[model samples]
Target: MGRDLSGTIRSFLIILALSTCCFTTAPPDLQARVEQLEKYYVEIKEHFEAKIIDLETKVVRLEAKVEKQDSLLADLKKGHKPLKENVDINQHCRQNATLRTCHEIHVANPSYPSGMYWIDPDGQGIGDPPIHVYCEMEAEQSDVKGTTSILHDSESQMDIGNCTEPGCYSRPIKYYASDRQIEALIQLSTYCHQNIMYHCRKTPLNFNGIAYAWWNDKDGERHKFSNRSTTCDQLAYTEGYDLQYVVDNVSLPITRIHFSNPFKGFGQHQVSRLRCRGKAKTEAMPRSCEDLWRMGHNLNGIYSVKGAKQMETVFCQFDKRPNEQDFQKRIGYQDIKTRPVYFSGEGRRLFMEKLIPIPFDHDVVNIGGAMDSHSGVFTAPSTGTYFFSFTGLTGFKGGVVITEFTFLSSRGVEEKIMKHSTISFSKLTTFNPITVQSTLRLQAGDKVWINLDFRNDATFRFVDNTIFSGWLLEEEI
Candidate 1:
């Protein structure tokens, strides 16, 4: 409005000037008219400026309202509980409700580039606190996507050449995040990798199947810079020579790096940036307690899993029964025969090598149904340590009674485990009993039984006092 009014006033003044020029004199009312037009333009400009200011204020308020509405809508769509108005969802990566890592952020918003971000690796309210970290979100041909944590970067070279051994120089790695936080990330991740770069001088990293440099992984295991090969000869020949390697065999993180100068060569070396990345296990589904434990679950209690046949809940005693089922594996049996069983070594068998399995025909208890009373064999339902005990009495006849616990492998091979012998030479020692116990580790499908043998050619008689018992002790993961 101000501009239009000014243009109209200028046009009117121009016409008056032209007319005055034609008459060679100015009209008396020309000055008064111009002053009146100027006053009117000032009033119009003031009014329009006030209106523009008012409209701008209204737009700002509307934008604030829209932002609030968007936040509420997003929460509703994700089925998340509405947060307080004072809470800022963007405070940390996990605070976004769905973005646990920077990789997830990049996935949610593809246009987001890699940079520093606040990440709560252990989730929003558990484990370690949030920490700032750099992320690498660049898309590559391999289609690999994950959050990367920088461990170490050698901005300048450092030489270590005074000694001559596999670990001539060792340095503990300084990671960007705490060890607990990194371990939490590894548990949540399906696959993890670390990139390593080494710059060597005149001496090669490896020669004639001997490595001069290696690093220890998160589990304190050593991994050579090169296998039993001379590949480093080609890569680390000159001062500027370098080699890049990726560690992905195990999901564990790296804790330290080492270099060696076995030949005492005139060479120097420097390690470049070490970055680790982990891909989230979005599809992880644990089917057993072992699986849960492997996934970083450390608590013990009743948990559900896909059992041998169907879904079932079992007690997870991670400290001992790591892979045990809900039912206890225990069995006890005894030979409850009315007639006396006789064992004669005179013509039946040799002195020590020959053995006969005890026929414990009566069962006292078979909890897990792993022991067979008919065959007198206890088959291990799972791989674990077990305890077995046997008690036998020489009824009335005096003889040397020897008994032992033997293991029958799945391959049908028998191995002696534990043995006990009793000497009953007189009537006073006729009732002497032999008790033997042992703890053995058995694999799944392995079988165990008791064997009887006589040390001498004397006959030994046994009654219903013969007893055998076994139970699972601890399960292995």
Candidate 2:
């Protein structure tokens, strides 16, 4: 449409001059031809000017149409909104229907990552949240600030509702996760709480130890070795000659584990699964090691639980003596408290049922001997196997009553040794006898004692014939 106005005018004038020559009125010479051509050009100029104006008008209309199309294309690029895709709320689960399997989320910012916890757990905060959808934005994206309540496809939606807007991963979140996340994260999210259209990235966890004592806590929290070794209830187990050790959460980078006790097991049948377990040092019972809950061991292997205190039986009564290491250790009993003394049943005093700490200076046996009569406690002079025997006489007022206990105190822990026996006072005139015998291993610094528990209103006393004794059978175990 770009017309050359001057060129068109010259062509028209040349054609008119040729036609005038045919009429034979104008001269063919330079002066005469020029004068005639100039006159014709002046007349055609008016028409050319009018034709140029018409072309210019057409150009303006085309430009307007192009602008309109450019605007329309921009609208098309924005696409549609409020996406609708069906999703199953129960897509993932392991133990419970609502709880979903998930990994812990890690990010550079202290605040949660994009799309974290957006899906609701429906009050079941049992698993790890796959993403940080529910987190707030610490700083508004300055580029889109206050532009609209509905954040754009590339913006962050801090508020609620189906704000499934696409967003970049460049910004920071407003705050930190809840306290539970700070302690440890288990499952990431429940199936029902997952986002329908959004996919959040999961953080990677470092690989841990080997299978021998592999336990897994979602965040590896249980793997940490604690400061205190035993729980309150563990302190009461004073039976069997078992070797024990405490394993704390480790601080190594490798995910593999390498730990085992000397306890022997064979063909899975005689073996016990060494499970990861824990408890507050002050608590009575240890809880399963949930931190490393998923870690497992070989079927019949002798293994130890990581981040747990273990009491394993390395030897039974018939086993050989302790190794050379144990031979060097001794818990010297200060005196030879062995005895074959006897008490008389002929003259017995009334003794009511009650707990009595032994070693009372008046108990008849060596008052100030190696055994402390005041507290009824005896310190293990050496690490050795000991045989303890107890005999008691009953008064006529007594019924059947025989329940006693032994206590061992060591390393700030007090444990109870279980003992049971039966004594009947069928013949009121004759003294009833009760006896209990036990063999155990004692460590140096350990304090052992017997507890006399009386039953019924009937009374009983150590007859002049009664006797209590103990001696080491072997040392080092």
Candidate 3:
């Protein structure tokens, strides 16, 4: 027992010694210091800190310079203007302190032929100075790194098919008539690979930043220009076999082309035998590459049911087999949408302080059953811009005062679409008619209805001639 106790006590003492050895005690605060050295060390620390601050400032300035260079690179992709022949290529055009760089190769080549461009039908130093004619073409691309000849199509381009004529896959031709007015001729060959002729027309559809071009299709119904993003330029819309030419398969034809802006003398009158031009190729090619094909409208006898026919050409650009693959993609590319709803009221009395739903039950073409004719409410069929128009005729013979308000209903609150205010016809009460039309962007499943000014205790009745109609204008991509 004595020996066991002795060993246990010795082990306890050994453990205590090991614990003490593992961790050394913290040192006591030093009081002995040379006042001169202490001050010198502090100054040295401050000097190093100042150097660090200076380095950080330089880094910030360097980063800003890099960002400015990046912005200049981005502008190069948009497009470029002329620079002095002797000036270094680095100098860029500046507007309001913003840089405009030259066009980037990738940006220029991708969106090639689909833009509205101005061209001169007659080359420079020709008969007339330079009549700026609007032209359009579908942009095609090739690995064509060097110059392209107007007379030839590159074999290196992707194999589309057999060329019906020459100039199937050609490079974009751009000529500068002064730096300001440059002309571009895009080569979008037809499916049969023939140069396309265009029957140009002036369309006066400029409203609310939206332009429209209308034409009669083979179906005989006047169709609106389908390409929405471009101003009226040159459209390669002529297709189908010409009574003059015989061929293999019928090619797809463009019904019409529309522009967003109005040109002074374009599309207003039908120009008989309108003249157009193409670019020149080698030095041997004439500088003035004038085309001898004159096209005009042949609209003397053919008429619409309403006897409305514009002066249009018979077949400006003759084609036996149309390139449906291309035309179908460029024109009429958007889904032919017909989410149309129309409502009419036959002198129906409207009650005050109540939602007035016009039972415009005339089913013209309702795709998604959005317009409930009996309920007088139109639920949105899709998310897009829609056009709505309403016309009403009423007389204040009852000496009743009323205000009408139209509202669009959704999850949040009703938004006022449009309203008409007619004073009490106390002295003169006749069947006065009021009409209102509006284009609205609606979300999917949104609802629309009318109300007879509930807050104003208004009441009114619409005449038999009253009408409310709307159609989907466009769908968001």
Candidate 4:
């Protein structure tokens, strides 16, 4: 519309000039006609300029609304409830600061002691509600320095009397925080610690290779007191000491401590505390290297982050700053020595819908840890365009190797983005390999993977030299 109005104005000016020239060839009222024409042109120009200004203003407003709608849609797709009207998501924290975790609060205010504090992770008005968590601020100053948030702390000492029989165990540790919150905290942490102390008297930690006591760690992995060589010996002394053990797995948040009172009627056994705390990798608790870069960190090296699932060590590519949103996200896979066989037959045409995902089990370059080598799926760290390439050799059995590339959206919708097939005319044909490459735009939480077709009733296998790789091309701000 603006373009059309400008064209109209230009044509009017041209016609007015032509009229003025025609009148100049005649006599009397030429000067008067020119003055009137000039006045009319000025009025027309002002009218059109005003309309253009109004259009531009409306366009800006519409763009802003669209951007907001997009953000809200993304949150909803991630299973978040629509926010209440007029409520800003980032204002849930103290003083309207964007503090995502207790660690960030501690970093912002170093004087704040260990206590219950409210954190608005996943922002406010989303599915995630603001949760009050106990932050163990002392851990930052203690040994193994980092900020710690207490996920679970036993209320009182638990006693396990000598029950020589089996099946004696304590309850699973219940956490105050939600599972999502706990997972987020773990992702933000570099390490976790749990304090366990046993009050013992004239009783053995274990006997005859049977453990008298054990505790389940955060991941539910059981660790016996007798398993740690000197742990049982340390407990044998007259006075018990606090066994501050660093938790091996920081992925999970809760733990359960168990003690089988095998020394019933002989000695006593009691658990002092089962306090679990996660020490953050950094005070900032940035989720990605892009976050660190945005926070003004210029160093380029490996850094820990709260990844999509757990804590991930990713290389920060700060040396190259294509844009403010350009944080490194690259992954590569190779050394897939094992051959996976998929069988398909003519009658199995419908089975093509369920393509077998290829497992790129080795990673040569995983900068952002976005690719899961085990699952052969690349999860987008953020909404962005990414470059992906896969090269593989077919097995000696000359058969059709149909490969399908797929994209799983955040909304649980799967779309076939690309498909390639390598065929052999005969069994005598050898070295039939296939390669697929494409640039894909994916939203955060979207997954991409390569699948092989097993719909021809033949065994299909990709050779050992197969390579699958991808990297972030550009991020959407």
Residue 153, candidate 1: alpha-carbon lDDT: 31
Stretches off by above 4 angstroms in model 1 are: 1-99, 107-111, 141-143, 153-157, 161-166, 207-211, 228-240, 261-286, 289-303, 314-401, 405-453, 457-477
lDDT of 1 by residue, 1-477 (tens): 557657766866676576557445645676766676567656665565445444544554454456656666777798987554422434533444534455655666654444445665555554466655555666573344545554343323446545677667776665656666666556555556665556554455666677767788877888876553344465444444556667773635667777765544444444433344555443266666656655445455777665434455555654433323542222212432111111111111222234656666566776667877655678887777788887666544466776789899888888888877777666443666677888888888998877776655545455346677877766553
lDDT of each: 0.58, 0.35, 0.36, 0.56
In angstroms, how far off is 445's CA in candidate 1?
15
Provide the global lDDT of candidate 1 against the true structure.
Answer: 0.58
lDDT of 4 by residue, 165-236 (tens): 532746566655665555544544455444455555434556667666567765677776645534434335
Query: Which one is best on lDDT?
Result: 1
TM per prediction:
0.49, 0.25, 0.27, 0.39
Q: Count of backbone clashes for each model?
A: 0, 49, 14, 5
lDDT of 3 at 188: 17
Which pairs of residues collide in candidate 4? 162-261, 162-264, 163-261, 344-457, 345-457
Lowest summed-lDDT stretch of 10 residues in model 4?
A: 337-346
Select the stronger candidate by TM-score from 1 and 4.
1
With candidate 3 superimposed using the best TM-score fit, by how many Å does residue 473's alpha carbon deviate from the native? Answer: 0.2
Give the C-alpha lDDT of model 4: 0.56
**Top-TM-score structure, candidate number:** 1
Q: What is candidate 2's local distance difference test score?
A: 0.35
Q: Answer with 2 or 4, whichever has the higher TM-score.
A: 4
